[model samples]
Target: MTVEITGIILMFLITVLFAYPLGKYFSKVFKGEKTVTDFMNPVERFFFRVCGIHPDESMNWKQFLKALLTINLLWLVYAFFLLIFQDKLPLNPDGNPGQTPDLAFNTAISFLVNCDLQHYSGESGVTYLTQLFVITFLMFVSAATGITALIAVLNGLREKTTQNLGNFWNIFTKTITRILLPLCIVGAILLVFSGTPSSFDGKDSLTTLQGDNVQVSRGPAAGMIAIKHIGTNGGGWFGANSAHPLENPTYLTNMLEMIMQMIIPLALIFTLGFYLNRRKLARVIFGIMTIGMLCLVIPTIISEIGGNPAIEKMGVSQLTGAMEGKEVRFGPAASGYWSTVTTIISTGSVNSMHDSSMPVSGVMQMLGMMINAFYGGCGVGLLNYLIYIIIAVFISGLMVGRTPEFMGHKVEAREVKIATLVTLLSAFLIKGFTALAAYMVAHHPETGWAVQPANWLNNPSYHGFSEMLYEYTSANANNGSGFEGLGDNNIFWNVTTGFVLLLARFIPIIGPVAIIGLMASKKFIPESPGTLRTDSWTFGVVTLAVIIVINALSFFPALALGPIAEYFSLK
Candidate 1:
């Protein structure tokens, strides 16, 4: 027990220790400063020129978003068609079939948005051709998409007033060439060394000790698995995700994978400070975000480590904690901590089955997605936090009877409205969609739909309600983890959550970038004694309060209907 707790603490400390230096490196990358990866400059220039792009060209926020959306749309159309015809393409040693149209639509958007919510299983549903072209290709770009968009926000925040942030194509190219590509290369090597597969070999027939024959799926998984975590694009090479023995092989790999997922998200906080030259401000933001993580994770760890009381009611000893749906190699403590981290960071990878976690742990996982800002996903996580900060800074200024100024710009109604709408959109999508699905279950469970609503849920009553709620929440947060207790492979979930996934990923991103761009164009205000000290501990408390209140108001009732209700029912 003590050892597992220690290991969890050590994992977090190692990540932060590594993040500090990486943040410094990130600061340099965004500023167009020289770096160790300058060797990639030639490759970047060649790629840009081939694509008819000028790396030196600058763009305003609107133009920047235009380029981002245009490319994403192109990729979506390309991936959808390719997925629908994958079986006819190359790389099908396993003779895997092509995806159905609706599943293809959902899968393409899910990966394209950096939300790798798989409605179809990884190994069987996708050929190695689609896996490499659609899944892996999108993982790289979608993550780069979020991070590069964040660079725009960072550039805007750094300036007192400016119209253009930077060149989108240039930042995008450099982000992939210098940062993401190198990191994935290194991560892929480490994973392969640690027993993850890197081969293109198809299913290998084998006989177990009990003489039963099984065909185990194998492929070029190490490369995708690398960015799957490092980019926090947590789609798996296998259906079991990180829990698969091949994907995450050892205890060392578990720690390594978690650290890789967390590094950029945490480092970006410090990068924000370095980018703005406001180290104190970064510290405050990091402190608040860390506290948010602890609040969610501590309860999860304790509950999971405390074992299941319902199981304790039986004669079976549970001194080893709740081991159901968890890996024996990782143990409950690490799995509980992982459950919280993956959900909060929007990585959405799992080493344990979340549906089998204690109901209290389920609430924490949902809360992580509901809040959706603590450490967040890649470059986008910082963007999510900035929205909360804007709202907090605005409210704090109103209370103090002063103009709200953040980083030398006034907080106005336009910015606040954008932030509020983005915040409310999550509540709307999750609750609104879940309500519709629930209505279908109650009123039309036996409808003539292809996949009946009566069979949608794998559990009954309150726990069943949570399965539905968790799916949409995951989609809305752009966190692709599922309860796995929901039978969501059908058209109903695929199409509905498809729209939710699209709106949720882009809108929150658009809100922050737009806000920062607007603020960057506003007249600069010099610091006054009357000006709020945004970097102080006082502002941290205010931001924390705003996060709590907004999330509670937006999600508390829905939570009560799902995980909260189930927690007590277990009792």
Candidate 2:
């Protein structure tokens, strides 16, 4: 237990230590200041030139969003066809088949939006060509897309009053060339040396210790695994994700992947401080996020390390904790911590099966995704929290009988409406879809539907409800981790989740950027004694309170029916 506790502490400390410096670097890179990766400017310029994008030409918020949406649409079309006809494409050394249309739609949208939710397994479902060109390509660009949106927001924040945010194409190019690519290359090298395979060679026949033969599937995984972690795009090369020995081989690799998943999101928080010259504000936001994260992490770790009391009553030894669906190399504590981190960050990669975790641990995991703002994926973390910040600022102003303002911009009806919609949409989709699934399962079980709810669940009762809730929650959060007990590959889940992914992934981003843009266009107001300072510790506490209160009000009922119910039932 001590060792497990120590490992979790060390992982977080190391992540912070690395994130600080990287955050500074990110500020430099995005702010167009010179840094180590300045040499890559030539490559960036080349791409811009070829794409007919003038790096100097800035855009208004509308133009920027139009470009973002258009490009994503095109990418979606390309990826859809690629998945549908992957067998006809190159690099299928294993002769993997193409995806079904519904699955293709779900997958293409998933990666394009940076969700990376895998309804289909990688080894048997997708071809290597699709993996590299489609999956890997989207991983880089989708993450860049999130970062680029935040960059636009920062541009809006930095200016006292300006119509132009920045050039979307320029930021996107630099995000790939300057930030993601370099990190991916370095991570790939480390993974390759750490025994993760990087070759295109097909399956290798191996003799087991029992004298039985086995065919071990292999592919170019190191590259995908690198960005999958660094970008917080957590779809695995294998069905088991990081739990697979080939994907996560050792403790060292596990530690590295864990750190990689968190480093960028954490750094982005600091990047805001550095870029906006608002170190105090940054510290406040970071503190609130950290507190919220630890609130989930600590309880999860305790529950996981304590094992299940039910099993104990059955006269079974659980001294090693709940080891059923976890890798021995990474025990319950490590898996528990990883579960917390992965869900919180919107990186859905799992080192253990979330389905097999303790009920309380499931609650924490679901809460991580439910809140979906504690150091979220890439740039989306701060963007999501911006909604809560807006609400908090408005509430604080109301309490003090002052006009609501944030960073010199008035929080009026327009901004509030958009923020509120973006915030509520996730809850709507999660609860709405879960309720539909439950209703279908109960009232219409024998309808010969593509996905009968009765056939879809691996567990019955409360845990079964959890599986349905977790799937929609994961989709709505754009966190791709699953309860794994849900049979979600059918057309119903694929199409339903596809719609959820599109709305959940894009609206939150668009809403925040639009809010920032609207605020940026407003006249700057000087700070006065009556004005609420967002950078203060008091405001930070208020922001945290607002997040908790809102989430509890909105989600507590749905949660009561799922993990919370399961938890009580277990007791």
Candidate 3:
């Protein structure tokens, strides 16, 4: 018990220790200040020249978003075609067939949007060519896309009165060349040395102790695994993800993978402080996020380490804790902590099966995604929190009978409306889709659809409802982790989740950037006694309250029907 608790504490301390320095480094990289990766500038310039992008040319919010959307659309098309015809493509040593159209559409959008909510298994479903060119490529760019959006918001926030955010193409290329590429290369080398395979050789046949033959799949997984976690793009090379021995061979690799999943998201929070020269404000935001994250993590760890009460009542000893759906290598403590971190950061990489966890642990996972802003993924974490900040500022201003302002910029009706819409849209998608699935399961069980509700779930009753709710919640949060008990690869899931992924991803990003842009263009107001100090501990409390209240109001009913209900039933 002591060891488990110690491990969890060590993970948090190491993450923060590394993230602070990395945050400073990121500020330097993004601000065009001198740094170690300056040599990569020539490569960055070369890409810009080839792409006909002017590095010096800046854009307003609209132009930046247009470029972002257009490029993503093109990438989606490219990935869709690649998936649909993968068998005919090069590097398909395993001779895997192409994906069906619906699956292809879902997959393309999933990876392209950085959600990586894979309905198909990696080994059997995708060719090596598609894995490298399509999956790996999108992992880099999609993460870069989120970072670029955050950079634009920082540009808006830092400058007192500027219509122009930086160039999208420039930031995108530099983010890859300067940040993600370097880290991935180093991490990949470490993974390779750690015995993760980095070869294109096909399956190796082996005779077991009992003399049965087995064909073991192998691939260039080390590099992909590194980027998948580092980029917070959680599509695994194998369907089992980090739980597979080949994907994560040892305890050392497990620790590294867990750290990689969170480092960037953690760093980006401090990057806000460094970039905006608002260290105090950054500290406040970081504290609030950390508090919220720990609130989820501590309870989850306790529940998981306590094991299942129902099993205990049957005279079974659970001294090793909840080992049912968890990896023995990682154990319950590591798995529980990983679950909270993955969901909180929106990384979605699992070291254990979430489906087999306790109902309370499921509730923690759901709450992590339901809030969806504590340290979050890549650049989107701070951006998501910015929505809460806007709402908090408005509410605080109302309480004091003054005009709302954040960072000296007035929070107007336009900004509030956009933030509110972005906030509500997540609830709308999650609850709406879950309700639809529930209704279909109850009323139209024999519709002959590719996915009948009765056939969709692997577990029935309250647990079954959780599977449905979890799928949509994962999709809506863009977190990519699933309950796994749901049969979600059919046309109905593929298409519906595709649209949900698109809207959930882009709108949250676009809303924050647009609000920042609108605020950036407004005349800077001087801080007065009446103005709320966002950097203070008081504002942090208010922000936390707003997040809790809004999420509670939005998700409590749906949660009551799912994990909450199951939790009580278990009791």
* Shift in Å, residue 126, candidate 1: 0.4
| CA lDDT, candidate 3, residue 158 | 94
Off by over 4 Å in 1: none
For all candidates in order, the CA lDDT equals 0.92, 0.92, 0.91
Candidate 3 C-alpha error for residue 94, in Å: 1.7
Better of 2 and 3 by lDDT: 2
User: What is candidate 3's lDDT per residue for 407-495, written digit by digit as tens?
Assistant: 99999999999999999999999999988988999899898886676799988888899998998888888889999878999998999
What residue runs in model 2 are displaced by over 4 Å at the alpha carbon? none
Clashing pairs in 2: none
TM-score of 2: 0.99
lDDT tens per residue, model 2, 1-571: 8988888899899999999999999999887888998888788778888989898798999999999999999999999999999999889988889899999999999998888889998889998899999999999999999999999999999989998989999998889888899999998899999999999998789899999988998899999999999999999999999999989998889999999999999999999999999999999999999999999999988888888878878998988798879999999999999999999999999999999998888889999998999999999988999999999988898999988999888999899999889888988999999999899888888878776667999999889999999999999988999998799999889999999999998999999999999999999998888789999999999999999998999889988888788888778
Which RMSD does model 2 reach against the true structure? Answer: 1.0
What TM-score, to 2 decimals, does candidate 3 have? 0.99
The alpha-carbon lDDT assigned to residue 402 of candidate 3 equals: 88
